[model samples]
Target: MLGDDRGQSNLDFLFGISVFLLTFLYAVTFIPGMFTPYQPGAIDLSAVAYRTSAMLAEDPGWCNSTAAGGLPGNSSWEDHQDCLLRIGLAGDRGHPNILSLNKIKALESLVASDYTLVREKMGLNGSIIYDINVAVEMNGTSLINAPWPSASSQNIESIERVVLIDTGKELFVDCNNPGEQYNSNMLNVTLNNLTSRDRDITIRIYNLTAAYPIGLAQDPIRVVSLSGNAISLPPDDYIIKLNGEVKNSTDFGFMKGDVLEITILNTAISDPIISAVNIWANSSCMPGRPVDYVYDPVFKQKSVCYPGIMRVEVWSYAFS
Candidate 1:
């Protein structure tokens, strides 16, 4: 009876051991799969919102016109003229070409509207002068290829004459004569040999409005030299007025048939800044009207006027 009991106990022990090994093996294989996390397929609310909003915010006009290359004729002219005028006015002021198209157009419209009223009310003869000129170029060339009177007419006459006097280049200052000695806080400038004999000569300082004197009061300033020659200056960084007025300076004056040398000097607080000096006739007996001018990057300069018309040029210098 004791032997039978021992045999039964051994069988039970073996059975228990088999069951424990099988359970351990099963857990080792299945435990890792159970604990591993699955990636969620749920959509991200924020990502969807951002992408949709970005698409909606894009400019409709720009998108519509992007594939349609080149500006329309009128739009091109308007853009060009606006840019030119800003550049012309950027005299003793800040940089002009840095402005965007929208800003420039707004400014041009305002100036044109205001000046139109002023000219009519004042009965100004000849033409109402504006401070700037806008220029345009198409297809990397200045000569407008469009037929006369077409939307892109190269001829200046076909376009609406917003400003009565139409010159490819806009004349800001219309003084009869200019003098020599001019002074400013930073430097002294002088013009010489200007007289009635000079015959409607004009000295244009580009980027004038960008520099110091912002308006007519600060500009259209006169300088008188010892020789009694008189010169009118639109405000420019290169030209300075003594006592803040040209009339008080002795070295200022214009002489008939003489070369005018413009000098710029530096001050303690500022380095000397000078622009290209351009001298030309205010008007000419040229039969052709001034074509709406454009910049020629290939030429590395602005447009050239037709034969018998005034030409524009640029000069630059570095201060010591």
Candidate 2:
């Protein structure tokens, strides 16, 4: 029996051990999901947190467009809570890691009122029943702060990512830019090229003052074309503020250093391709001629996102 040990020589033993090690290493190397768990539920919370953050940062979110009384695919999820399939902050479907300010505000309301539903929608309420908390910070200010999970849970995983929020940069036209603005009584704000669905545009025309005070007599200041269309009344679609105070269309009060503020309520209207507010002289203000001074190149408002950090923490329920 002792002599039979020669059957398995040193060379054969080394060869067998080397083959085993190679197979073991190959198996470990080929196995995926060691770093990124693409599936909804991951083996650990760390991967889950990363994936959840990605879902929020990348997806523009979609609601049931085919269901009864359904909303559009790109419509805000907060508006249609029942048909909400997923909650995402990315405003535009093509861009990723760029969140929508409107959606961020909606998430704040959701987390505060319906946190349980938020957890379920986030895929944290699976067979394992994990809990999650999200926090969004912008320059050290907490935009969103979700409540933490159970206190008994010992293990927790967290992940953070930098993202942008589209806060809708304020569009303003310097009234002082044009030297003729001091003498002109009519300024046209053409919104014929506006495409953004949620835009709060404010057009200011300062120094509407003349040599002598008119006070609705010499020139009755009236909003001629509401939303760039003639004879469109009702202050619902837009707002006219005389020196920062809300005034009706007929409330004519032109004064020195008068800042004619026109805030177009974009949400109430749809596909507003026409001019927003056209400051023109009525028949009494200027007869036999149209006083329309349109800005040479209309302002093309583009969507820009502000960068910030988003932290997502996940934990499992420690049932006693």
Task: Show where candidate 2 strays beyond 4 Å.
Answer: 1-42, 66-72, 145-152, 169-297, 318-320
Kindly report which residue stretches of model 1 are placed more than 4 angstroms away from their true locations once superposed. 1-196, 208-213, 225-320
What tens-digit string does per-residue lDDT give for candidate 1 at 209-282?
12222222233334434544444444342343332234333234333222222222122102111121222222
Clashing pairs in 2: 191-275
Scored against the true structure, residue 23 in model 1 reaches a CA lDDT of 100
Model 2, C-alpha of 77: deviation from truth (Å): 2.0
Candidate 1 has what TM-score?
A: 0.16
| TM-scores of all predicted structures | 0.16, 0.54
Error of 2 at 27 (Å): 20
